[model samples]
Target: MTVPAATEGTANRPAPRQNKRNKPTGVDILVLVLTIVGAIAIAFPFLLILINSFKSPADYNSTGPLSFPGSLYLDGIVNFWERVNFPEKLWNSIWISGTVAVFAVVISVLNAFAIGIGRIRGNTWVVLAFLLANLLPQEALLYPLYNMFKAVGLYNNPWSVVIIFTVIQSAFGTYLLASVFGTFPKEVLEAAALDGASRWTTLWRVIVPISRPTLSVLLIFFFIWTWNEFLIPLTFLVDNSTQTVPVAISVLQGDRLMDVTTTSASALLGVIPTLIFFLIFQRTLTRGITAGAVK
Candidate 1:
């Protein structure tokens, strides 16, 4: 009844056809190639900026924009930093963006909790209003906000930008948080209630802790948006000392447009905070974005 040794050996051998099926197909190869090319296309501009920022003014002018520098030159960066008052503007950007992120996340969390978990009367209408407001373009509110801030004597103040960005960014944050909170487990909330936890206690002790991923995403978004905001900061923070990095960089570029190396250096410096922030929080950001998509 025993099988022959040759037949048994053949049966134990792995199938070459099955292994061949597991190899990447032609479509996968095509996608890999396209992805590599697309990434290079997207990254080339930033690479160009970083390289040329190190070039001397003469080299930058004489050489093609994308060409490698003949020698490492850092004078442009030094001059750009000093001429733009980078330290002061960087501090201004830090405080303004930080304030906006904190206020936006806190306010959005409370609003989302009330609308999503509280299930209060008229919650639907409130969410609808927020969604609609988020759809409105910034240009629509710019002049009105300007006049209001001016009338209140808040114009040319950093708080003015803070308030405007906080309000605008909170609208979207509220929408996102509402979705996340709405999906929160009912059993957990009920258990907390049975344990005599007040709504505020439950929120602080249970909800906020669980919602950290989504809140982190909101915080990063608000910070980056506030940091990069130009129009409101330009209109409201007119004073030279109060201007944020983006506005300061814009002014520097205008005054030194002929100096490509200097302008590029200033622009590159302005981009650093956002780049660093994103790189640091990229994992949490990906999780937060995908959280709402799932149960």
Candidate 2:
């Protein structure tokens, strides 16, 4: 009886697993190794820039691009500040980017919402207008708009740049937001209306909350675009104090050519804020994009 019971227990045991299928093929292993190498290759420039940013300009210029500086120094930073007035430039960039992003997002959102839900007259025409704005080359409008601004006494003002930037940014932003707003479940919105929510309330409490991901993506992209903007600032603002980082970098050249070391350091410095912005919003940016796509 004891032997029979032991045999039954042994029969109930599972078979041993196969190691063959769990192992990677030679090709698979090679692909993984190549992928790692490719990623490193892509990342090398950023690593080089970051490391070189801490070096003194003299040390950086003396060393090969791949070599480390003998002594880390703030000379590059000091030169960057004196040459560019970096603080003022950075502040101007921040202010302009923030203002443009806010107005663009708000105007785009409201326009999108109205077109998406209002069932108003000339909706198709409004969309067509947005498309036309996008189709026109910005350069074509530059001369005409410059003239218009001159007539209106706006050509050299920051307000001119701000308004133009907002309008230019709004075209694409409106299109993107309108697409997002269109994807919202009409049934849910109808239900909210039936529950006695006003259009403003439904928009603020319902649509906006559900649309966070799309909005996040738009905010990050818009801010980055505004921050890097150069031509518009150059066209509008003549004051040195009001120049954004990109314009400042352009003028980093003295009477002759730009100082290579100082300009390199300034270029490196210019990359920092955009990098910080991306890092801060990366998680939301990814999640929002994924959610928007799914919607």
Candidate 1 deviates by what RMSD? 3.4
lDDT of each: 0.89, 0.82
Candidate 2 residue lDDT tens string, 1-295? 2669778888999998777766798999999999999999998877787777676656766876677778776676788788778999999999889888889888888989987777558877887788788788767878988999999998778788889889988888887777667667889999999999999999899998988788878888889998988777887888888889998888766433644456667778898999998999899999998987684
- Per model, state how many residue pairs clash: 0, 0
lDDT of 1 by residue, 9-32 (tens): 999998786434577989999999
Candidate 1 collision pairs: none
Stretches > 4 Å off in candidate 1: 1-21, 290-294
